[model samples]
Target chain A: MRATTIHAPGDIRLSDVPDPALSAPTDAIVKVVAGAICGSDLWPYRGAKAITSGATVGHECVGVVEEIGGEVRDFRPGDFVIVPFVHCDNTCAHCRAGVQSACVNAGHTRSGQGEYAVVTQADGSLVKTRGVPHADLVPSLLTLTDVMATGWHAAVSAGVRPGSTAVVVGDGAVGLCAVIAAARMGAEKVVVLSRHEPRQQLARAFGATHVVADRGDAAISAVEEITDGIGADAVLECVGTAEALTTARRAARPGAIVGYVGAGHGVEMPVRPMFEKNVGLVGGMAPVRRYLPDLLDLVLEGAIDPGRVFDLTLPLDKVAEGYRAMHERRAIKVLLQP
Target chain B: MRATTIHAPGDIRLSDVPDPALSAPTDAIVKVVAGAICGSDLWPYRGAKAITSGATVGHECVGVVEEIGGEVRDFRPGDFVIVPFVHCDNTCAHCRAGVQSACVNAGHTRSGQGEYAVVTQADGSLVKTRGVPHADLVPSLLTLTDVMATGWHAAVSAGVRPGSTAVVVGDGAVGLCAVIAAARMGAEKVVVLSRHEPRQQLARAFGATHVVADRGDAAISAVEEITDGIGADAVLECVGTAEALTTARRAARPGAIVGYVGAGHGVEMPVRPMFEKNVGLVGGMAPVRRYLPDLLDLVLEGAIDPGRVFDLTLPLDKVAEGYRAMHERRAIKVLLQP
Candidate 1:
């Protein structure tokens, strides 16, 4: 199978890797139909995070189940499904609490950026789609496996109530998706902090009511001005950078919640200031599995087109170019057809 | 009027100061019937936080209204009320959001450790008691003005639910009060991290089901072990130091909330670990005014006795000794009779 591998920093390539087979009754083999590069992938691609010489890259996808172990009860061979980013038993207390990302029997399968990927805990991790989605809708459906679900998690975690103002910090696919999530959650005003023209356009299309091209204090002031100096009721921190966290913190109103899905590499909170402002800092790894059902429904019903995040798509053989596009800020997200 | 003043660090003195007056149209003059020293006072008294020479201290008290400015219409002369530490106009957006501590028109009354103090935003800051609480209930009622309300805020902000495990970090008055708040909120188990015997006793008295007389990693490990290695669902951080914050962070279960009310002087969040664990950090300046109505009812109904935090009493003239006792850990809290 041709799988994407990152052999050292800035070295992404297509390599022939072993095809997966179900190793446990709780497992299934997924023939990956589509996958997407994640913001987290840039961590190693930019050498900000260290990875092994050859690590199977990517953690998002939708696929058709080629085979399933006998114990996998909810799924069967030839079922088109959404594979959540984390593998979990789902019956554990954590998973039962809707935090499957922290499931007790947690494990990870090889990256989905491959032709065939092994999926453990298949019954709990795979969400069966109504049918194989159209190829045009595949990219959008694929996002439910992670990105869209993650963005929805931010809104749900922040308690973005109807008629409230929601602010999103970041211009990436997830951030744009958050704008859509907040809107779907009935937010009256959706604000975004973006400087890039393409991201700004996507953000507006996704229901961002206000866009602040300014950074730092200017951005915060822009939000404050739009909110009548009150700040947003809910803030979504989509970027894992310190600056993004700062924007989320500063943009939140007193008693507001700042829900962040950022893999905070070096993020730190100024406790005193946040304390004084009474901003509730919440959100982490999205319980993507928990949100998948609702989000998949939204996607299928045309309530949201979060899949539009995939502005660029490439054949599995051209995975390198996909990463390069994201690296160069040319693509908001890239869907790789395997 | 005689008031407690911090001439310099470790130099508390009872000094003659001018009587408070109606500095603003929203002000009221109160003759303090009861006042309590707070853990925060130790910060300046112990030279941890700088204070200007002759700056008045204390912020917690219950008093009788002596005079009211023309604009203060809620109460006439001779109404007993709980004076929350921070004064805020109830009409601001923050106050409307139930975050009175961050009200736009915020101000502070004169320090409670005085014969008379001026109350600003009287209509919003003063919670008129059903009547003068019995002399025996005075100290407890005084706690509702700040400590108890602050503790309640921690439990409320953390979203303490029935059958959830709660952990209280810090052995101070606020921590003890948090134990009571958690119990009141129906937490299944309330744990306290404390090495002080008196505080441990008080914590248990306030409904702490378990006591772990350990600090740092050991304290976290003790909690983890108690919860079958899952950690507590809610953690109340009453101490503002780094160590306390670290313990609270490490002791929370995945997706748990750590509600902290400490005035974080030098606190920071270790974002990576907390993010990976999906812990939500919330809580701030305990919108005491918002919780006063409920807490006052609890106190009046013989439900919670948070006033037990005040273990020592001193006359107004002995203000110096009161500071010394708390600074030396000889007293948990001091009540000043003016």
Candidate 2:
């Protein structure tokens, strides 16, 4: 089987690996049909985050169950499924409370960007489609594995309501998807902060009513100006940079919440401003598993086209080019066909 | 006129000061009927917070509007009113959103412990009762000015719901009041952390369903045991100390929110654990002005007895003793009559 592996900084390769096998009774062997590179993957490829020299990479995929363990009752061979980045039993206290990302018995899909991947907690983590749908819908279904679900989590956690104003910080795939989530949730105004022209245009196409090309303090000022100094009714922080978090917090109105889905690094939560303005900070590793069911339905019904985030695609063997394209900002996201 | 003044650390004095007068069109002269020593007062008195020598002290009081400025319309001479600790115009964007503490044109009542105090934003900051109430209801009305409303803010910010479990992480007047707030808000189980016997008894009397006397990590363990290791659905953080904040965050179940109201000192917000568990941190200085009307109605209707927190009383001249008693924990709270 060919799988994506990280060997060193700026080093991505499609290397031959052993085929995945079910290791537990709750596991299933998935033959990946489509997978996408994640923004988080850039952390290690850019040497910003330490990674094992030859570790499997990628956590977003749509696949067909090639085999299932004896105890996996809901899924079997030949079923098409969306694999959430994190696996959970779906019966833990956290999962029962709809916070599956914090499930006590959490697991991860092995070698997701590969020909075959082993999915643990199969019945609890995989959401099966009505059938292996047409090829045109696979990209949208693939996004539900991570990015699209994460974007929806941001909207829900920020408490986006009908007739409210929503501000999305960052213009990555997740941020663009968040624009769709906010619009779908009925926000009267959807403001996005993006300096990139291409991302901004896509954001507008996805439902952003306003776009700010400013950065840092300037971005905050722009958002404030757009909101008439009242600040956003809901703020979706899709980028985890300290500056982005600061902008998100400053963009919120008094009593409004900032729902952050990005993985934070070297970021200090702003306590004083958040306290004084009564702004709330919530959200984390999005419970994509919990949102997978509804999001899959939305994608199936053509209510949203989140797959548009994939601006480039390649054969699984050309995975290195996919990483390079995204690393250099030539592509918003790259889909790999296995 | 006699007003409570802070001379230095551990020093509280009732000093002769000039009689307060209407300083602005929105101001009114309040003839103090009741004023109480707050836990916050002890910060400066204990030297934890710096104070200007001879600065007027006390911010909680119920009084009669002895004189109204030219622009004052809703209040008039001899009208009984509850003066929120912080004054807000109540028409600013933040105020309209029910976060009066973040009001742009905020002010404070001048020397509330004195015989006559100047109230700014009078019409917006003072909630008038139907008439001069019976003496028995005065204490509860006084409480609405600060502690009771603050406790209610904690519960509201924590998103307390019917049948949910709530954990209060302080045992002071505010925390005890929070027990009542949580119960009134329909929490099925109200757990209070109180090591003091008297405060514990008071907490129980105020509708706390469970009392944990342990401190620090032990307290967290005790709460988990009480909730069968599931944690509280809502956590009210009435004390802003780092340890209290830590306990509050740790005691919340995944997806729970911790509403904090204490004036934080030397505290850092924990971002990692909060993000990991999807627990939200919110609340700050309580927006007491926004809650005055409804709380005043509850107090007037005898539906709540928040005044029970005031366990001691003294003549206005004995204001120093009132401070000493509260500082030494000899009294749960002290009420001074002027």
Q: Give fnat for candidates 1, 2 and onward, in order.
A: 0.85, 0.56
Model 1 segments more than 4 A misplaced? none
As for candidate 2, its clashing pairs are: none
What lDDT does model 1 reach? Answer: 0.88
Candidate 1 lDDT tens digits, A25-82:
9999888999889988999999999889887888888889999999988888889999
Per-prediction TM-score: 0.98, 0.96
